[model samples]
Target: MTKWSYDTNGTPGLDSVHAHALVCVTFSVYILAQVLRRQVRVTGLVVTKFFMIHVMNLAMLKLEAGVWGLVFMTCTLLYFYETLPVRYLPVQEKVVLITGCDRGIGHNLAKQLDQLGFYVYAGCLQKGSEGEQELVRNCSSRLTTLQLDVCQLEQVENAVNKVTNELGNKELWGIVNNAGICFVGNVETMTTADIQKLITVNYLGPVNICKAFFPLLRKGKGRLVNISSNAGLAPVPEMGVYCASKAALATMTEVWRYELQKWGIKVATIIPSGYKTGILAYDKQATAERWWRSASDAVKEDYGKECFYAKPKTEALLSPDLSPILDALVDALLSKSPKAYYYRGIFSRALPFLYLHLPTTLGDLVMKVIGDWFISKPLALQKSSKKF
Candidate 1:
């Protein structure tokens, strides 16, 4: 065997290993350049950038020349073909029920679906709230506002019954389990009640709604879309509870898809990057104050008040526009053959891609670096380190 060796000029010679290494380095540099050039919008699948990334990946795989490389190349080609849209379902005959229509993603999605000619059942937390009223005032007669609080079984049951009665001959074509909330605090400081509240609203709420509406979905052979977060795919500090709930939702979606395959019902999970949705707190200062007040004295002392109270210099890096997420939801609902997972928004695909595809150790290192940069150091840690 010819062992790997550097040439007399001290350059990496044209050996297979060296060639692969060179390609990998070049690929990394190109990706980084694109990321910077696009001002952090590299994740958007703009035609040119999308093709460039795939072409570069193909080049690197070709240089490596292995069975695994060939497999990846084949998968890449398949994905490229799968993206081309064709043969959409007729919206005029479809009816969709979307939870959390009181605000945020669900509210917008309900309006969009209604405009697209789907009879929309908009589930609002309150019967006469501004969101519900707005939908009633603006949307067509095809859109109906239902009083729904997913956390309550009674409410979910009531909504389902009403929707069933109104459908008459039409089956419910889709159900979007979009009612969810997020709480950001260290797990150690989070109260048991808070943890339970997060689980109930984020996880169990969807479960209850699904079970109640399953029969209708079967009748229609409808689509089930779960609005999950990127946090579920890539867990992070200060969001353990939220992440766990969404992770559970995502897993359940997969299981339901398999179980419901006999009924011809499709299941899709929309994993979106952080967006300025109603689910999140825009008033960071007020949120910090609430969390601080709720913390126990011992917990407060350990982490210190400054750690919890210091406002972020800038707003959280959340996308103000919800269009990316809306697009994904529409695709999942309307596409003739929907994807099992629709990763939308900036960093939504990139985070999961890195976590799932990279070697475990390398993935951990990258996640650690990202966490360290994004998360703040506790004041208690600084105090303890100073003593040492």
Candidate 2:
């Protein structure tokens, strides 16, 4: 290290360095603030103010304008970036409906929405289920839980009737299509019934809810947040059915944006990678019980289980936190305009990014390798254990 010379006055060497670092940090934060100008003007201005003093002092420094200018310009351009805003719209107390409010991401979302001061209207297949009842009891004062299986037209209609009657045809600020089901099995082994049930629960269920609630949303001039998946954007091996439904849902969300924009319905799809939610646990338990059964021992030995069979232990996966997503959903519901998609968590984003943008061959190679990695490890471990 170079020996530090004393300051002209009494300031220490470390203090000078700290001052310089503060200037650099201030400049950095100023640039970041410029990015938020379009989304939230006041917030961006606050960031600009944070860096002003440092930037003014540093203006006399012998730094190259090219470097700082480039940083500033890059941040300016980020305002126009295509991704969803980190902070969307302000939270407001407006009527909201969310399907699949019993458990998983939906349960978390409902709670968070309620906390955020929205008039939450949660829908479930059955109201009296232990988990469902518990959620209903603890929600905010404005919450209304109703038995409405999106798959059942009568139930959906009944729920709508209740909302219209109770709220007196008040507009709905948010609608979350969170209802989903997974049927895990090999494509070769999956029966028609398995695929059908998954499709009904994942795709048609959302569609039915949308159809029923579109009028209320239009009246409220709110947003639609669909809980799609990274699988919807990029396929998952051994999860063809789940992927298909989500893919369809993603497609439908896009179309809805196009269709409903004139009606003041902002649409957003939350596409996350596989989450370590109740869904994954349920699938893992079900897969363990039946995937290897009724199958030839030769098939199990030669082909082994799929990579997704080991997905439950995926550390990168985030458990559903109703806060961030619920915040996003509420924001989307209130935004005058919204992005097509919002992504969160770790692999939830990176995996889909690679799959969608990579060249077909390269993408296939990566996916195949991931597939083999997840599929092979457990089988290898099992075999080694057996030998011992």
Candidate 3:
């Protein structure tokens, strides 16, 4: 064999330069195409084009970093590709239980899985609610609807018993912990009761459901799919309680993943970005009014009546498509090897990456700027003369 000599010169070889250039150009093109396709309005298009130019400029800056940069880039691409294989297991023999099937992602996922031939047990909070009724109307014989309140331990046990009785010799393959609630308010404005409610529904609900169903999952060598939020990964101002609750659930899921691996029970946490679901459609104004009315005179004076009542201007930040989340959930459930963490929706992956990589000060500053731009004072507030 011929001996090889390593390059000792500081200057990059021609091959290295060409490789770096190719990577920069290819990535810039892909990003530009994504921006153009997703952004539809004239203003959005102009803004996106400007953003893409900035990204291209950053990409060009990597060209001067030489061989090491190119090598690192190549390795990253290879690792990403290797990790994202699409291997799925047959679900016809599997039995799945999904909570909060009365509406939103849970409703859609239950339907999709039912259609895919999984014996789906949908957990609805209300048996005869409009959403449950719709699910009943649309579903096939493979789908079964059960009344489930994840927050109540007795109800969770009853659901477990019902599913156990129904499953007979078949094992319970998966449990989708999709039941949750969202509460938006400043920490000062949010009452003890409000915080408790948020914690009960968003965090403890999953805990109760998972604990009851984990044994069955172990028996089946199945998976647990928890529907978390992007807020769990990166906390947002004014929605502190909601973020905290989701964060708790995420941490719990991670711990369970470590604990359950011995039994071949996979755990997946799905962190979705904003979607136009029932949670987002909540009447913020009415909630604000209720908080204002309950506030003590001393508490009211410090924050101001206007501040307490202010409704942040709401807009859909990401695509309303529930398909991505549903697909991710299915992959977590049925894939022979599922990802431990699935970040779904636009900006879901990017935002978390930035938050984890950026300096603490820089990340805080970025968040502050975003909060200032998006959060605004309420358009209307009832005048109050009361002072502590």
Q: Which candidate gets the maximum lDDT versus the true structure?
A: 1
lDDT of each: 0.78, 0.70, 0.77
The parts of candidate 2 lying over 4 Å away from their true place are 1-72, 75-77, 80-93, 291-311, 315-322, 359-361, 373-388
How well does candidate 3 match the true structure in TM-score terms?
A: 0.78
Give the Å shift of residue 94 in candidate 3: 0.8
lDDT of 2 by residue, 297-318 (tens): 6656754655225453354555
Which candidate leads in TM-score? 3
Q: What is the TM-score of each candidate against the true structure?
A: 0.77, 0.74, 0.78
Task: Tell me the alpha-carbon RMSD of every candidate.
Answer: 9.2, 8.5, 8.5
Error at 290, model 1, angstroms: 4.0
Model 1 scores worst on lDDT over the 10 consecutive residues at 38-47
After superposition, the stretches of candidate 3 with alpha carbons farther than 4 Å from their true spots are: 1-73, 310-314, 373-388
Any residue pairs clashing in model 1, and if so which? Answer: none
lDDT of 3 by residue, 1-388 (tens): 2222345776435454456557656755654564466422234544554465445445744555455565666665454333433447777679999999999999999899988988999999999999999989999988899889887788889989998898987889999999888766777776778889899989999889888888888999998899888888886777788889999999999999999999988899998886765776567678778888888777676666666553545444546788878888988997777888888776677667778999999989877765554334432322233331
Order the candidate numbers by TM-score, best to worst: 3, 1, 2
Q: How close is candidate 2 to the true structure, as a TM-score?
A: 0.74
Is 2 or 3 the stronger prediction by lDDT? 3
